[model samples]
Target: MKWYKKWLLIIVAIFVMIPLFIGIIQHNKKLPSHISFEGPTYKTDELEFLYDLTYQKNEERVLEQQLLGTALEIINEAENFLVVDMFLYNDDYDRDKGEYPNSAQKITNALVEKRKDNPTMSITVLTDAVNTLYGSTNNPYFETLEDNNINVLITNVKPLRDSNPIYSSIWRPYLQWWQPSQEGFLPNAFNPDGRKGSIGSYLDLINFKANHRKIILNESRAMLTSANLTHDGSSYHSNIGFVVQGDILKDIYLSEQAVANMTGYTLPDVTFKSSNETNGELEIQLVTEGKIKKALLGALAEADEQSTIKIGVFYISDRQIVKGIKEAAKRGANVQMILDPNKDAFGIEKNGIPNRQVAAELVPNKNIEVRFYDTNGEQFHSKFVIVTDEDETTLIGGSANFTRRNLADYNLESNLVINMPKTHVLTKEINDYFDRMWNNDDGQFTVEFEKYEDQTLWKKAFYRLQEFTGLSTF
Candidate 1:
């Protein structure tokens, strides 16, 4: 070969090999301490299940939101120290869409008021970098919280595994040095009229990982929910939550501390009063990252002929979870799922690539049934699964959706695993919540499987490709 041709071939090989090497190392790198964690199971009597619902009644949308209200109440009742980690904490929405509740503003006011009332109290708010559009624009909410002496930390998601490794591998080596700045003319992908973002912001956005944990806790109690504090565009989206008081709060605090440590912030030292009692009726465990997937799989594996599995989630495209559901159905367990139709993202239409294709794969079994929530202009953003046997009920829920990005250690996710007797009030309440939506008792909540069924061959191929390669967002 000619000398010049040999050098050119070497250069081409280098360009291809660099990203491949980076992608492999980053995906399997040793995560920060306590990334994928599973807290010990604690028994306690203080477990409350709360949910929010938006349904059409008499041609009008009726909102029955309880999770955010309960979260605000928790914020107001904190006395000494407060630690909150929310995925979304901004009020950016389409202003042309009539009127919507300023949920983020309400949370800010509550935090500021509480800070004013207790000047010595320690308050820390942790949120994802997406709220700032990957630091291209300033977040007003973070500024307001900092102005009130509240510590606000944007989680450093770089250390987390790259979900979209194909793009992130190239960007990490070549373009990650381009820091996002406020001076840019590119249209923001989230909000068109919002502050324009820089090329660096768009580059960072393609990495597609986040600290997607919605949690609030003081020394005494903690609440884990699927709802974000920013509800401007999704105020009426259905959601769910759980409030508990016990040693589990320590586990939650420790999880947040791990994120804080990654972000170079130290959380205030606040000791929790543990309920030493272990045999209480309600048992709870805090699971994060891949642990959430483990807990769900364990619960599903235990389902048998006499068992029933109920899942209500915004997205359900994880392969293992899909196989688990099918195996459970094959074992003669009744499996019913309430899924969003993969449509309506802040007034933007979405192609039903995932859920519709997944539902098509699931509904063939006689024991399995699937239904899509009847969303008018909002979404069914709840994420929880309930598996009931003759003796006990297992409920897994929090911010983690059943997706590769959310469950496979790619994103920082948090969830709670609650195990209680069949007769427990919390279990009954959760079952009732599912039944109301499944049966549409007095409300037009869910539609039949035929409503949005899609068996498109290309979409199925696309969903499989996206789920396997982590190329598309769930």
Candidate 2:
């Protein structure tokens, strides 16, 4: 063969083999079954439900968000061990924002102090590599934790299914092997012009999967939330969480240990088992990843003429669940959704895509009501579903967004499925929360679909494309 022709053939072979290699690894990636544990649920008096609505009113910002505060409290009060798996745990906001409240740093400080107080205590923080921009840069906050003898587990994405296969195909064979050089050359993906990343970091940005669970497991209690410890995320975003003190904490610990094991972290021989003792009247189930989708589908299938389903979520792009919801509305179940408009991220403004389009799809059904979560400057970053029947009420909530990447087992997500008596205090409180937001009581929690409805054909196509292809940030 001619020398030039041989070189061209080599390049073509490289392109072809890379994708095949990625496909092989992605197909063979091992993932355990989604953990589900059902135990006695606690009532309102037995457990605390922490919720805060961060908003702007009268030209002033009201940051009532308290999920991070509760997480910090749990860490400070932990006596033996502290395990946290957070999706985002870095200070990566745009510098133009002018130094936001550094929540991640504060949490790190608390952990460091706790270690100092009791040098034998164990602290492990598991977080996504996105905080470090796919290992392109170093996170000072995480480094500080490690400096204090805390164990930091950055999730190994190699075992995760490729969400954006096009990028993963190229990234796997060539760039995946490149060492993450701290010798900065490229601008930081999170905050450009502040800190630079290595070439490998830029390459890894193409793979858009994450360990998105926001869980804090301590000896006495456990919390599952939709809030991140990132400085930018803490102040301006509205979030929600559940803090339970029961046998469920042990279940949470085991589930978190599974995540640690995935990244090759050998947790101490911790004896964690559900005590099987009753905490209160509410019955709880810990559902993760694909199990959550199954529970959601089953609950939607149960909706009937007399049932009402209310959802407030950050994103909703899962087709099976969406279709089930539509079917429920068609069957005379009252269905309502207050979804984020997908309008802003950090300092970037976005056009409403998935939420608006989803709203438009259900608008034609009289039994369905769709509204946009009213926001001042930040996103309504909560993911929850409440279903009420004549006798029983069910609430599913946690860090999982209703999107393909979030539900299809591509991301490490955890949620709680609670079935309680219709008249139970916890049930009443969740119902009241929906009612307050729906009625615009006290603050403007939501606006009618007409306020920000975007049914543009192009956007519908775009949302579907991203949701289907997994080339999205949701």
Candidate 3:
């Protein structure tokens, strides 16, 4: 009967269409980022770490397998010193307090264990003054650290701000000369014991920040990440850490340690044994920011002759970074950018509507490679990049992203760029990851830039204006 024939046709269509629909959705070249609140590890002659973490895309361990291996290797081989900087330090193991043991805790434990093996071996941890004051005690990681004799230092603090906005704003003229870095407009009512004589409190002021994250092992390996020392940051939220080896670790450690001293924090003299250093002709640069946060984007502009750029980020709010990515790819750098694709209603959407959409637009560029990621299922929350220059000097690791605020003028951002490890294994893994992301346009349900590229001129103009006023940061 005709009715039976219609049903059969419909059934066939449903079966065939389902596969097509999935195919359409699953195509994307952006590789599947790791899904773990737990930090990622890689191998290197020496291991490195970056700790201060607030956003993704700027925090995830975004390099190849070998790099992770290098991290583990550095830890295994640390013969001398291990220095770590953490903006957030927690010890409360109770899940009720926060989340699981983050990478910092793991590293802390590892350091303690390592110290037991070598009493002559020294371990130094520079934590933000804020951490010394804040966080839950359920885990008590900090107490263990203090027991271990790790050096604990707090950054400087100033005065307080008037609560009344009208009065606060009106009184600015008289208070203009008054600097919180020196003394706040008014002395804080309550101050911690160690913070006596300081008029302003560390909690009330905004001008000062001590965001620093790094982990260096025996001048061999180092890690850089955006994940804090909280539970949500590790098992529940998202975070990324990079492990680096070779000579670059020492340079980066030195720069960051210097910033710590500038913030009125006590620090030990840090320098690597020359015998352990590498002389790879690879181009390596160390960028850092704290009280003196470095210009992250300006450095990117300097990344000419780049063959490929691998970006993993947590938060991006810098406009200059946007322009730089566009400019770099437009100028022929094979840029593969991976981002947190949490476009759901529950998520806190960033970079506004138009700016957010521009992210989709940048994906399909002829020269650039873009992969939007949403791996909340496991854990792919981090911000970093794996960049290869034209001459083939690959730079891996750090806490910087090509965002308006991160690279230009916003929250303090720090990064450590080191020469690629001698082993080609990690580089190849990263390349493969990028290739997967670039071609799997539908595999990951990515938004196509081509779809929006054809928008009319007027519509584009309207969206551009919206980008400036509508969005806070992406």
| Top candidate when judged by TM-score against the true structure | 1
Q: Write the per-residue lDDT of candidate 3 for residues 99-127, one digit (tens) a residue.
A: 33355566566667776777766666666
Q: After superposition, how far is residue 242 of candidate 3 from its true place, in Å?
A: 4.6
List the candidates' TM-scores in order.
0.98, 0.92, 0.58
C-alpha RMSD values across all candidates:
1.3, 2.9, 19.4
Poorest lDDT segment (10 consecutive residues) of candidate 1: 91-100
RMSD of 2: 2.9
Q: Is candidate 1 or candidate 2 better by lDDT?
A: 1
lDDT of 3 at 470: 23
Best by lDDT: 1
Ranking according to TM-score, highest score first: 1, 2, 3
Residue-wise lDDT of candidate 2 within 1-474, one digit each (tens)? 999999999999888987888776774476753333233344433466777786546656666766878888999898878898888887787767445677887888989999999898878999998887777678898889888899999988567677777677777776788877778688776775556788877777768888899998887778898888655544668778988776677668778777787788877755443444555677777888877898899899999999999999989988898899999988889998989988877766778778888888878887999888887557898899898889998889999999988887788889988888899888888888888888877776788999997769998998899988778877
What lDDT tens digits, residue by residue, belong to model 1 across residues 1-474?
A: 999999999999999999999999998888899889999998888888898899988888888988788888889999879998998888776665545688889889999999999998999999988899998899988999999999999999888888998898999888899989999778877776799989989888888889899998987778899988565776778999888897788889999999999999888789776665666898889999999999999999999999999999999999999999999999999999999998887777899879999999999987999999999778899999999999999999999999999999999999999999999988889999999999999889999999999989999999999998888878
TM-score: the better of candidates 1 and 3: 1
Q: lDDT scores for all predictions?
A: 0.90, 0.80, 0.46
In the predicted model 2, the residue pairs found to clash are 41-282
Cα error, residue 45 of model 2, in Å, equals 7.4
Q: How many residue pairs clash in each candidate?
A: 0, 1, 97
